[model samples]
Target chain A: MRHDDLCHEVVSNLPTHGDCFVARDATRNDSGAIMDDENKKQINERYEKHLEKGERFWPDTIFRDLIMSLGIFTLLILLATFVGIPAEPKADPSDTSYIPRPEWYFLFLFKFLALYGQLPVIGKIEWLATVLVPSVALGVLTLIPFIERSPRRHYSKRVLPISIMTIMVVGIVLLTLMSEVPTVSEDGSTLLGTLQTVVGIFIPLTAYVLLFVFKNNTRLMLWTTGLAAVSMIFISGTVLTLAPEKKTEETEVATTLVDQIFAGQDLYSVHCTECHGDDGSIAVIEGVEGLEGEKITPIHSRDVLYTITDSAMLEVIAYGRPNAGMPPFGKTYGGELSRSEMDYIVVFMRYMWDDRFEVPQEALKPLFPPLAEGEVPSYNVHILPIVKRYCISCHRPGKDNNNYLMTTYEEILTTGDNAANNIIAGDENSYFLQVIQEQPIMNPENPEEELIGVMPPTRPLKPNVVDAFLRWIMNGMPRTAAETGALSTTPTPEVTPTP
Target chain B: MWKNIYLWLDERIGFNDLNKNLLDRPEPKTTWWNTLGSASLFLFVLQGLTGIFLTVYYTPSPDHAYDSVQYIMEGVAFGWLIRGIHHWGATLMVILVFIHMLRVFYTASFKYPRELTWLIGIGLFLTTLGMGFTGYLLPWNQKAFWATTVGTQIAGTAPYIGEFILKALRGGPDLSALTLQRFFSAHIWMIPAALAGLIGVHLFLIIKHGESHFPTKDD
Candidate 1:
């Protein structure tokens, strides 16, 4: 039960210096002594008076910690159960639209990227933020213990460090929160918006600088600077809140084709501009020449854009001319562009190159059928051509349209989205009819009415073409112009029942 | 029965001596702030356990890695919980180890005989960061992919050996299957082995030079 009896066997075995440091009153005890209960009691008293506070690691500290770790483990289990980790869409290297964001802890560094990206000189050398600054920060962090050897544990004594730490924590937290916030406005034209952000950053930074300068007036500096910091934050918050909010995602407005074409242009500039040039006229791609050693065709050239039909161009865009060194741009083809996005690119190319494809403002109205009274629209002349032109682009083989290929009548009639046939002759309830009319395309089995978008994606068929198709189906879709009269006598089995 | 077993083991191996040595050590007078080191160690153990569990199902290839993680999350029983603990435990370990370092620095406990300990602690810190960085890309998601790209690009910015380091890290100019394998090896095998050895030295140092006493008004 004596100190030396209990501890000496291990203490003696320990490296020589261990016993020396272990003896709290190193000077009081000799190099080697079998301390009795009386000496042990005095050592304990001295320990009590000299040391601040501590508990034994095993029973007291470790036990409570084991319980705390159990609690943390339980919390982690709960977090796992409720807040499930995200396993995002599989890593598709071809998908250019993906916004790569780091984990939340790294958001502060991510925000530093946004800051460094805007600055003139630092922006050029991205490693300044990405590598050098962060490396420097980490190096400083590692070296702090070696540098600051002052034996002061109390917070009150370390004003500079505590303040710097406070500022750092606050700064990192604020920056992380601001990581998603845009410096530029929606259109990306306004310098003032970015200027406001820079001013917002500098305000608190200036306050801190002033606070450091006036550290002598400690209490007054804390108050006035704290107030200034708060007020500046409030002012910046107001400015940022009131400033035109940055458009995070492009709003899909169901308006005219002009805007759709404009959106397509924007997307083209993002995805294709590097290879195809700004005007889509670059024969030799600047960066890609070394990659594949092929010269790209000028997409904006009159012979290329004007000669090729829209559907053919869509096919080229979707499937890509891999032999010609162009990669596929369609999602179905393991590329990024959706069916609608490909359509947009087509529209943009057509508008830019072929003046015949240009839409005048006056002709923007829906091209509905100006049907002559009692003159039935022909299937071959009217409906077939329209389907061939517009619907078959995506609905054909290799494209994703639920296998409802418009090429064959049987495929169209039989294949719908696992729910209903696409086009039942003489039935208004047909899926094809529903979709073309801009009506809600529903799934019959689900209790909650699920709605798929209108077919042919972004742009609907001309109203006249939709009407022609409608009349053809409603009049018991004929094989030709002559077979239209046969509808009166032929009882359409397709229209009789849903089952 | 357990006592008999303990005595049997203790008679042969002297297990009780080691246990007594560890448990009956003279602790420095300290508050809750001193517990960060223990907390960090606990989290490291937690990470090691969870990381081992993950490796059972985890595929190191670029193609299978993401799918394997998805399968672990969705198919395997309590895999999400294990993976989550590992992931969160990593962040927590980094934070706790950092706070422990800060405490040492603030108290100037890294001075005197403890300078080597502090230096070893810095190595441990770097090792812990290496674990985090290398482990991050195993998910093979966009965030992980691009973040690793940026992270390795930082190494690529070093003047003379930048290109070589970048190539060595990535196995080529771009991140590929080789890169994934390299990172996986570093995360699970290389860094952890280094950490274990460093930790051995660190604990020895802690025992050699007993934990620094809380500073009193006089000293």
Candidate 2:
């Protein structure tokens, strides 16, 4: 009479084969109830009946069950291999402008709130959508067995509950789909900031109303509700898709050279406009009272523009004009602007004040010397300025350059990181040139030498700049203009002017 | 050698008797729908396996959590595979469990003496969802943070104690380090333990009462 006895009795009444050896001894189940064989014969009859229609759970059910599980496991492996996972940028809490959205699975609830969040009255009681509605639906879902006690299982006999389930499934799917779609306009307006109640609530309510009106005709009710829901989603999606997107700030960063100059102008205003007036021509820098006595020239003046070439301008900007109170701005010189950003400021100055001097497609040659016809480049005029602008920041004395220094002619000629007297003039195998060219030398004595990486180390210097170094070295390292003319007949290649 | 080991264990464990009771039991004719329960169990086991591997590299703190997750994806060997399985497995488990319940409902498997099983199954369903909601916040990314913030706020809507519930669930009003800590523990420990216990009960009830069959023309 115990529950286990009833279970065994129930099992026994099912059909089984003639060799169906039954375990008839009273045994306690996990629940500690003794199962007896008082109705063993009757249970065997029930077993015989069910066995005619069923099989053992072991090989029959479990075998297929395991195979299905393996299929699911294989699916997980495929998704893991092919689809992969996503990890976005690290979280920055100070960035309040970031739009916070939930995972895709919870998009249904998100979309639900989005729908009801804007209405005049119901929006005030936002929890009705967030909490009350979902709870009621879940409560109904859990209470279904107690509510529906129909003895039949065929689809036709269970029309009411099945229909309700169909409608609920359709609703959740539609809402989830709606949530996934980009509903918020570019201006952060949801459905034009007005029709939220009509779209979010009334449409769903109307479908339910139709469902009640056609309750007796379950098929019609489902059809009407399903069609209505789908159409609502379709229409909303179509309208939202067709609207014009508002221009975000990112779109304003143009890609053309003119646009880059414009962008540079913006950057120049933030940094340089503080010292130089809005136009770069303010001769007496106004803001800083510290540099009031220094004779500062207008950078945009014809005299300055024609006198100081781009390379000299870059040098002044990179290493600060400390005596004149100008702070360094290049990242290399303990400042903020990158190499490319410094290029932008240079381009901006040219575009603003000296547009008549055409900016070359690339940086002009010997940006310091402004090479003349047949004028062999000098080390001080060309190489020294290039080194001061590019290398001196890291390579100068008292800095971390592996003992290399480029401040003066003697220092430039002496110290090196990998070898001594790195700059052997007229020797192409010089360690200096090799490092600049990113071709490191293996120690001939020690074959296990760890070939050091390139010099000006973070990135290779510009090709033209390296070529100038090559030309300078090949010309036997002319130090002075008179030394350059002395090396002029040293079989230097034809120095043609760049048209 | 195998036979000796089997015999040694069988003598103490009564393997034959256990097999007869658990495996050789008769059941209603199996159909495709019956496979859902097994599928749910399979995914849960998969999730547990992958979750263990992820925990090896995952830092629960807000500071290193995102970086650690990125390191797993980019740096660790087969870490992506493990995390991906865990991620997709959570979703598939929820879906399969829901379908299994639906199958039980449509067939009226909750009828008669099976009501307790159905009720336990509902508890299992809720536990699966709880596992999902808690697991989501552990990644500690933007989506995880905001989603959990909104998700927990729903629990905050309970009439009188809503404010208290919300604050307690979040470990504070705003999502913070403790929120990640709390959700990590719940996902890895609390809900999984509840799910395992409820699943045990659910299977016990199913075995106690024989499997319910589909209604036939005669019935």
Candidate 3:
């Protein structure tokens, strides 16, 4: 009989309701070999007696059968949402100093290769582990089903294959642990730990030995896995135990400045995260009713928080005034704020401003008058020296200027793509004219318009140099001091105080 | 109806029940090499499950990928655990699929009649890896984002076809919204569909080949 006939016959014997062809077919085997009149059907079927146990892929595999599995997975996905991840504050482009790392999964490989790069002789082949080893490992893995196809189902004979697999698992897990852990010295500079000598080198050396000598046994794979896992755990735990806690922050039981700042966080969160944002950085302005295109400068940045003083910070917060954009917030301007309440806002601002700064407000004020037009203050004697000192550290050609080149006077004129278009002649309209204006309301907040991100990015412009450059720009912006003798004759010695 | 098709396939494709008991032939299954396909299938399920969990909050923007991933690592409850599982699971799947391919090649399982299945499997492997590489760039973090930038930049370095491939992979000349959306869709839908189809074809061929008979020849 055909296979389909056999399948139908097999299905009939199984338990089913009487409404279908199944029950009648099983009760009475009446059909003859209907192909011929001379031949009759076989009455006794050998396989039909034991019909309960069938083949692995018996019965129709329907879409409905698979949907339940899919449902379970869908439920798992739903559960993950509730148990979902927490997002860190959004990235700050200005904070280019933050070191980026890979996802935790890749961390093992990352940390592994970093270790491999430390090895000698074959060391430069560290890419072999980071790139090639994993590649080859997967290559060998995909090639497995073809290597040993003898139908040997037992584990004893499968030792070599299993060993190879175990080694990879162990290696990856160990590397992952190392990447995540902090480094610390073992012991208090006394006796070495009992396992230190063997732990450091012997273990790895022994694994290498086993790869050759004990390649066929399960022991090698087991040991390799064990050693990797143990080392990872030990290294991580020991480092964590001996590692110094953050050296900068101390618990101020006696009420320190940080404590006061911490106390003010709640108030700040309610009022500040809206504009300055949760991290005191990455300020994005949604269009509000009164404010269209209203953008608060990111405070989490090293620039704003780091540069201004606490008292100045308080005034800014209490007044809530910064040109036309920020409204006056204190009761003095019909906005609600007491002096102490204003101090709370200041505390929060200062805390965010400087991890180390704990100073008063006098530093942020403008002390000297900015140069007006027709004043030949100083350029060649003062301004040229300042450019050589502060501007060229990062803004030179063939460096990371993006496109901004300030290495030469020509490069300055070119400005490539983003020159200070705002620096208008005789008016405070150009980028060069607006940033660091004793009155800063004239310029757009875009940092790209200025040299060195508004120039001298980390420090303020010296008042004397500001006057010199201001005089030069106001005097129809002379590139060379031919007609205007503003310090053209005097050779001022370049004086940059060493950091 | 499908049963008729199976029989038709059996007769035409050199498939028979006797081939299952023919445990001495070396044309296919030689010893213990058949288990790899199973392991790879297992890991695929694991990765899919974990990946679905990760999609809950993984923003695809170039700017957000890093910070979001960091947040998941340090912020979510057992988020690191879920991420770890997904990460390790993907590594294992890739490893296993390669081994399966090797096993096929070493035994010459790709010879003639089974050649189509082998070719399809190879395509599936490449697709799987393509998925990983694309997914790798999605987190938009320092490593994921910049590594991707460097990776695409390397692709961009190709003589003439480089820029095209980079654009196709990155969804643009540089990493942007276009790149993120393209990668996200590919990771979630496109690659998965192709992988599923290939997996089905692979399984069908395995059953048709009847285990290639165990190794009776002496080593």
Candidate 4:
């Protein structure tokens, strides 16, 4: 009887047999005639013979499995201990600039969808790559046992399925490797895209077609799969080599409470210190462009900290009190700070000012490493952190700071209108030096007008900070620690006057 | 006194029958590749244990999820190790299961009496991926958030029911607190339960059939 007739018979007689296995076996007996009852009996006999000679599963198979599992356990612990998950910033639904990527395993499919989208007509149909291709592939994979019905166990006998799978697996791995390489370059060149299509989609596809055509010829099938896989790998390697170096975005994520507080403090100093005083104690904002003389509640006050929850505080900062003359600080509202940055600022306020939160000792460490008596302070070691904390808020671009941008070391010295006189090497009378010391640089043309106000109009730099600037300028403004080390003057007892 | 207690328990448990049926069965000679299946099982258990520990501290709300994870890493002792194992175990589980499937496919061990096992194995593989997808969103970090957004968006591309599927997966029109809560439920309870059930059947089938022998040219 035909397989359909047998299936119908089994279904019709399913109620008579209480055991479902009986019906299943009857259907299989007819459908799987490739391995007939005689063939199955012989296979069973062969398996029985092998079992007689084989080792016991208890000690042998179990032993290998235990060893493998133990090895994996060790590897997992090592990975967990040494390469812990990299910290990622909290989700910001409004941050559209973030390039979203799936977990590593799904990268192959991600690349496949991207490369497939470059196809002319069909690519426009989103479901073909996104839903259809994957569903079909998984369907084929799931039904492999029934699809390859030959019952051929050896690799030599199952050349078609084996070769197809080999090419498919190779394609998956290669596509994953090429996931970071964009299909199109920024300049709209499609060379990389076309090449990726070949590696990811075309080569494997062509090889599958050719393999089926050459199915009867095992050698030809193997050669097609081999050549296709090799070419895919080779072309992907070329694509990778030619690929532009990806710009690694350095976003410092503070993992520890101490680090978070420090990060928050630095951000608070730059962004908030202008409106609120350095300690968040200013009742009225002063010297700020639009909000001068505006009265505001002290954020550090117990009323504010105790009354406002963290979420409420976050919203207040992010949305800002428009009527109260406070501008939004969140990126979602067109401000500069990201969600994590805002979180850090909140953390800083809680630990530094709130009586409820106990601050960690490490968070209280000085901003920069303290200098020995004669040690020189470099731009990198001392000045950058100091500038970032105290100066960058106003000194940065689009601010009211006389076109002087302190965002970078070069810009600090070179960009301002008073660039020539801002940081004259070894000149104590430089405009930058004069301003930060609470010394206003008087306009030479009009002596009554201040060319620049004392730096950081809100608060004076601590004595140590001023001294570092003094040492940095006196040492001719070295940029690196190595450069500053060469200029260091060892403390000599001879130079010290007896008290 | 120990012997009397052991005897009493063994009488009820039938240790000898278990040894005969489960552990002491004869099999074809296996290789290192054959160990991948059991290794995958071991990883699953490891993940389950660590995941349970994670859920103790993990709050499934967008507002607290990120902070809770931070607290897990910072405030709770040995929380990092548990979370780390879970994180890496997930990646390792996917790899081992895939390789194990490949090994079974390449060896044609999925043929004849083992076809149902292969079918169940496929379910396990897909569910393992589902676990990864769901577990990823629980952290509610930028990477996890955006990845899930795009992931659900891709699911939403199916012709007829795509929108429904997307909504169903995300628990609404967009990823929100509800999406996080549902994903947390699926990750800890639903997917793992499905996996455990399927694993039990898979193990039963393996024991029933014994390991398949390496094929040779002899007919």
TM-score of each: 0.59, 0.60, 0.40, 0.91
Ranking by DockQ: 4, 2, 1, 3
Select the stronger candidate by DockQ from 1 and 4. Answer: 4
TM-score of chain B of 3: 0.78
lDDT of 2: 0.70
lDDT of each: 0.67, 0.70, 0.53, 0.88
Better of 2 and 4 by lDDT: 4
RMSD of each: 16.9, 18.8, 23.9, 7.9
- Candidate 2 per-residue lDDT over residues B74-190, each given as its tens digit: 678888888889988988888899889888887767765576888888899999988888998887765677778778877788788889989899899888899889999998999
- Candidate 4 residue spans exceeding 4 A from truth: A1-33, A368-382, A425-429, A437-439, A462-499
lDDT of 1 at A282: 69
Two-chain DockQ for each candidate model: 0.25, 0.33, 0.04, 0.74
Per-residue lDDT value at A247 in model 2 = 45
lDDT score for residue A9 of model 3: 74
TM-score, structure 4 vs. true = 0.91
CAPRI docking class of candidate 4: medium
Query: Candidate 3 — which residues are off by over 4 angstroms?
Result: A1-54, A59-78, A91-95, A121-126, A145-153, A182-208, A215-499, B1-129, B136-174, B181-185, B188-190, B206-219
- When sorted by TM-score, best at the front, the candidate numbers are 4, 2, 1, 3
The residue-level lDDT of candidate 1 at A376 comes to: 56
Against the true structure, candidate 1 reaches a TM-score of 0.59
Q: Could you list the iRMS of every candidate?
A: 6.1, 4.7, 11.4, 1.0
Chain B TM-score in each of the candidates: 0.95, 0.96, 0.78, 0.98
Tens digits of per-residue lDDT for model 4, A140-161: 9999877887654666667788
Give the distance in Å from residue B96's predicted Cα in candidate 1 to where it truly belongs.
3.6
